[model samples]
Target chain A: MEKSSVLTVLSALAHDTRLDVFRLLVRAGPEGMTAGSLAATLDIRSNTLSNNLVILSAAGLVRSAREGRAIRYFARMEQMRDLLGFLMEDCCGGQPELCQPVLDQITCPC
Target chain B: MEKSSVLTVLSALAHDTRLDVFRLLVRAGPEGMTAGSLAATLDIRSNTLSNNLVILSAAGLVRSAREGRAIRYFARMEQMRDLLGFLMEDCCGGQPELCQPVLDQITCPC
Candidate 1:
């Protein structure tokens, strides 16, 4: 990912509501969740949720698809992975041991 | 990391100059880089770099240490890993296949 694009994605995630929404969608997995469901679960107004979704979409972190009458938002796993990778490329100064905690946290199921 | 702290860190990295600074420090590893050097390399004013450094320090993404007459900044690797892990958990719907690109990009020495 380009630096500016990655910055945009990170910026979109630097908000409480938006972060929560992204986390929720990540947990929901590739199947995703409908906008109405996200709004209900997050207890955020539809207008506000819509705005957040727009930002996420613009950042390419999430993609919304029309499924029936609802728009389902799924985490754009590839873009997200790219963003994460970009930030962590040189993590722990090439000593993997120093980054054990991070690796464990991400890899551990529990 | 708490959600808020992660948000703060992400927010700090959302900017062009700050992100470049952080990435530079990360590439510099534990040795870190001096404020003046960072400013010169990035072609940003010292005052502006100082402000960005302050934000990065506040977000716990960077730490400043007094080295001789100058303070050097290093990437807080643990916090960075935490931030990356937090965003990447449940990535690719647990298939792991989908996140291969991200992993390769980060782990590849190229």
Candidate 2:
């Protein structure tokens, strides 16, 4: 990913509310959650949730699909992967072992 | 890492200049770079670099040590690891395969 893209994703997630929303959506998985449910679960105003979702969508961190009268939002896992890859691109200066701990932490055991 | 620390790190890196400086310091490794050299290399003003470094240090993304008359700064790899871990904590929710691609990319094969 380019620097600007990384910057956008970082900025989108830098906020407390957005980060919580993203994590909630990540846990919700591809099935996603309706914006109304998300707003209720997060205890955020509809307008505030709408604004955060817009920022996240613009950053390619989230995607929305219209289902019935509701809009369901899914966390874009690929984008998160790309951002992580960009951050670790030059890590350890070609010495992968130096980053083993990081690898261990991010590698899901389940 | 806590949400606040992650926010601080993200906010610190959201900027173009600070991101460049962080990536540069990451590539520079533990040997680090002097403030003067970092300023010249990035073509940034001393005060600007100083301010950025202070922000980075406060966010625990960078560490500085007095070397002679210069303060050499190194990227705090552990903190980066923690931040990445925090972001990926709920990824795939018990389905590692869903996040395998993310793992492969960040694994750092040398």
Candidate 3:
């Protein structure tokens, strides 16, 4: 990811509620959760959750897919990978070993 | 890596200049670089760089040490590791393999 894209993603995660929501979604994995369910779980109002989700979606951290009457939100692993890569890009001053441990973590199942 | 600490660190990184400076510091590693040198390299005024450094220091992302007349700044690797761990905590829902790649990267040589 470019610097701008990284900034966008980080900004989306800068807030308390949004960060909580995003972390939960990351745990939820690709299957995601319904908007209403997320709201209920977070103890947040639907409107507030919708607004937070919009911000996250805009930042490419989370995506929403309409499933009948409910909209499910899932963390975009690719975008997240891009984010981790951006921050780690050029890490260790050209010595990949310095960053090998972090790479060992944060993998995509697919 | 608590929520509030994460917010503080992320807020410090939210701005363009601060982000650039922090990234540079991270690249510089434990030895770090002098304040004046960093300002010169970034083409940012010393005062502006100083202010940004204060924010970063306050957020615990970087630490400053006096070397003669100038203070050299180093990325707080422990704090960074904490930040990463906080974000990745509970990742993959007990399946650590899911985060192995990222862990493979971002390690300390020590």
Candidate 4:
């Protein structure tokens, strides 16, 4: 990803509410969750949730699909992956050992 | 890492100049680069570099140590690891396969 894209993703996630929302959506899985559910679960106002979702969508971190009368939002795992890749792009500078621990931490044992 | 720390780190890196500076520091590795050199290399004014460095330092993303009359800044790899771990903490939610691609991209082949 380009620097500007990375910046956008980072800025989008920098907020406490947005990060929590993104994590919640990630845990919710492919089926995703509705704005109402997210607002209730996060104990946030609808307008606040709406604003955060807009920022996340704009950054490509979240996507919405209209399902019935509700819009379901799913975490865009690919975008998260891209942001992580950009963050670590210059890591270790060809020395794998330097960043091995970081890699180890990110990898799921399961 | 706490949510606040992640926010701080994310906000610190959200800017183009700061991200560029951090990446430069990362590539410079443990030995680090002096403030004077960073200013020259990034073509940023000393005040601007100083402000950016302060933000990076406050976020614990970079560390500076006095070297002669100058300060040399180095990327804090451990902190970067913490930030990445926090980001991926909820990823895949026990379904490692879902996040395997992200892991693959971040791991250095070298």
**Top model by TM-score, which number?**
3
Alpha-carbon local distance difference test for all models: 0.79, 0.83, 0.80, 0.82
DockQ of each: 0.36, 0.44, 0.55, 0.41
Candidate 1: where is the Cα deviation over 4 Å? A90-110, B90-110
Worst 10 residues of 1 chain B by lDDT: B101-110
lDDT of 3 by residue, B10-88 (tens): 7888889988887887788766889999999999999999999999999998899999999998877677666777777
Task: Tell me how far the alpha carbon of residue A83 in candidate 3 is from the true structure, in angstroms, after superposition.
Answer: 1.5
Candidate 2 lDDT, tens digit per residue, B43-104?
Answer: 99999999999999999999999989999998887787678777876676556566655544
Clashing pairs in 2: none
Total backbone collisions, model 1: 0
- Name the runs in model 2 displaced over 4 angstroms: A94-110, B94-110
Better of 2 and 3 by TM-score: 3
Q: Identify the candidate with maximal lDDT.
A: 2
What's model 4's TM-score?
Answer: 0.86
lDDT of 1 at A33: 93
- TM-scores for all candidates: the values are 0.82, 0.87, 0.88, 0.86
State which docking tier applies to candidate 1. Answer: acceptable
Estimate the lDDT of model 1: 0.79
Of the two candidates 3 and 4, the one with more favorable lDDT, higher being better, is 4
Q: Which residue pairs in candidate 1 collide?
A: none
